[model samples]
Target: MKAKTIFIVIVTVLLTIFLMDNKDAVDFNFIFVDDVPVSKLAVIGICILIGFVLGFLVGRPRKTYSSYNDEIEDNYPTEQPKSTLSDEDRDYIS
Candidate 1:
């Protein structure tokens, strides 16, 4: 798991640097509102709204079966095993 995390971090950093260095080569021109005269404030507002929605969705905690079961089990006390008795205690008396 540690190695996977490190690998992901290294890959993410390398990709970020590579993309930043070659950003000019990438064609990401938008034509919807670029050609027309539009309010810069409106574009900023739309971007903020989109970001808020995305953050809310990603930040929400995901539920799992184990989490539900853990909550239910917490309410009950678990049983423990009994101690072993002496060998004489195992002998049956007539």
Candidate 2:
């Protein structure tokens, strides 16, 4: 099997075991509420879902000044920035 398939299978088995072990109802506390009876599985699943969502939001790609300018220049061909260095400086760099 592919590595991805193997990993998914392992993860699924572990998650199933975890759910089975945590099937009991427990008193859960929230910021505004106190001692709410909720399933352990639901509590853990909700926390995991929140973590995944926050991770995706934090890790999503963002465009910087240069990349935004590049996209605009590629689409519109506006006045591109040119080098202002003297030939001596260019030769030194080379």
Candidate 3:
């Protein structure tokens, strides 16, 4: 399996074990609410989901935009770069 798959599996297993061990209810306090009775599993699962979403948003690649007035050099050359090759290497390529 891929590294990402393996990591997800391990994390999921760990989370499952943690949730199973902490099944009791606790008081969850939010911005507008008082001590609301909620399961520890729910609170922990929500926190984990929010963390994953935030991590994905922060780590995801973004496109860079250039303005029309800005001067930018051509980073990608159309011509192939020249490489110095030995006689044996050239012969092998041909």
lDDT of each: 0.64, 0.88, 0.86
Off by over 4 Å in 2: 1-5, 68-94
User: In model 1, where is the ten-residue run with the lowest total lDDT?
Assistant: 20-29
For residue 29, model 1's alpha carbon misses the true position, in angstroms, by 6.3
Clash tally for model 1: 0
What's the CA error at residue 31 for candidate 1, in Å? 3.6
- Give RMSD to native, each candidate: 8.8, 8.5, 7.4
- The true-structure Cα RMSD of candidate 3 reads 7.4
User: After superposition, which runs of candidate 1 have C-alpha atoms over 4 Å from their true positions?
Assistant: 1-29, 32-34, 68-94
Best by lDDT: 2
lDDT for predicted candidate 1 compared with the true structure: 0.64
**TM-score of every candidate:** 0.39, 0.57, 0.63
Q: Write the per-residue lDDT of candidate 3 for residues 5-84, one digit (tens) a residue.
A: 99999999999999888889999888999999999988888888999999999999897676443433355556777879
Top candidate when judged by TM-score against the true structure: 3
Give the C-alpha lDDT of model 3: 0.86
Select the stronger candidate by lDDT from 1 and 3: 3
Question: How many clashes in each structure?
Answer: 0, 0, 0
Candidate 1's displacement at residue 20, Å, is 31
